[model samples]
Target: MGTRKFQGIYQLHYEEAMGKIQTGDLLFCSGSYLVSELIKKASNSFMSHVAFLFEWYDRVLVFESVESMGVRIVPLLHYMTNYKNTGKKYNGGLFIARHEKLIDSYFDQTLLKNMIRTGIDSLNRNYDQTEIIRILTRIKLGVGKHKEDNYEYICSEFVDYCFQQIGVRFPRTMEGFIYPEHIAADSNVYPMFEIVS
Candidate 1:
């Protein structure tokens, strides 16, 4: 087969992505370690795919690619849930992609910036739950001007979901269920499922 277009490999830039996690950065993250481990181990376990959602300080990033860690990118959002395993029959908080639907709700820079601001305001107002929910809602609903889903979905989709309204596609790699945007810099990481659950 020709090289895979979107493979399971860590592909988001650390600093740049973190920058997005500003005041309006609204998204629920389990924890940094869990998100980080998912990507590091996915590359090792065959199956050919990796997806993750990550957060840094405050911002959250979402990213997905089929060409492994360093290759082509197939970005998606707004209805996309968490990543699933390679061949698992069942999973949760994971949504498959429908290019058209995603393109309809992409996030732009200004919108992201504003969202960050919103998040900050929520935090300042002591609205932890609301802030997080707002962040995820914007991501899932697609707010902002540019309307591109660069790498923000990862963090945004960490909250509650009504997958029933949206169809989900199971992850196709060992490293599944992670948000696409977030990642741990360390080399030694594994998916939450791999941690002897």
Candidate 2:
């Protein structure tokens, strides 16, 4: 396999990045929040969160599931300048990544619409707390072969499930748990821009 690099520290203004961003793009962050650190530790990667992008009538929105609020949509500008209505930029590196094959190439309007619709449907769904606990427990205890069924999802898994609507499958390690690092490591995903605080 050819070696690949994570996103660099070079900075780009959020306005410009958002203007150029396409629907079905990705956002990644290395947040310093306590939960974020735990995810980084679990995945052994610097990135703690993964979210998808959606373009809606001159607005760019982020589709994500957070521990505090579960699946929700936030304006792209929320991270660029103020985060969670705070007067400061979000606490970490914000990145825009593109899927080489699926974004503007292989995916058709039908698939794209289906993918986006699935993501929209997940709005207000609770973050999968049970799966997260199992993940952390397995991470610390080294247990394997655990699985269950549920409609709730963590951030990365939520994105993965949405992509499945378009027939794209990401790596699901540890009994179908998809992490932010797993999405980052995808061969088709490449960094396009970054916003450093």
Clashes of each: 49, 0
lDDT tens readout by residue for model 2, 148-182: 44778888888888888877778767476778888
lDDT of 1 by residue, 1-197 (tens): 11122233233333333433322112222222443344324333212223333344453443332212321122122213323333322231221121222233453445444433433332212112333344344445654222222232323222111111123232221223323332221121222211100
Report the number of the highest-TM-score candidate.
2
- Model 2 backbone overlap count: 0
How do all models score by TM-score? 0.21, 0.91
The count of residue-pair clashes in candidate 1 stands at 49
Which 10 successive residues of model 1 have the least lDDT summed?
156-165
**lDDT, residue 167, model 2:** 71
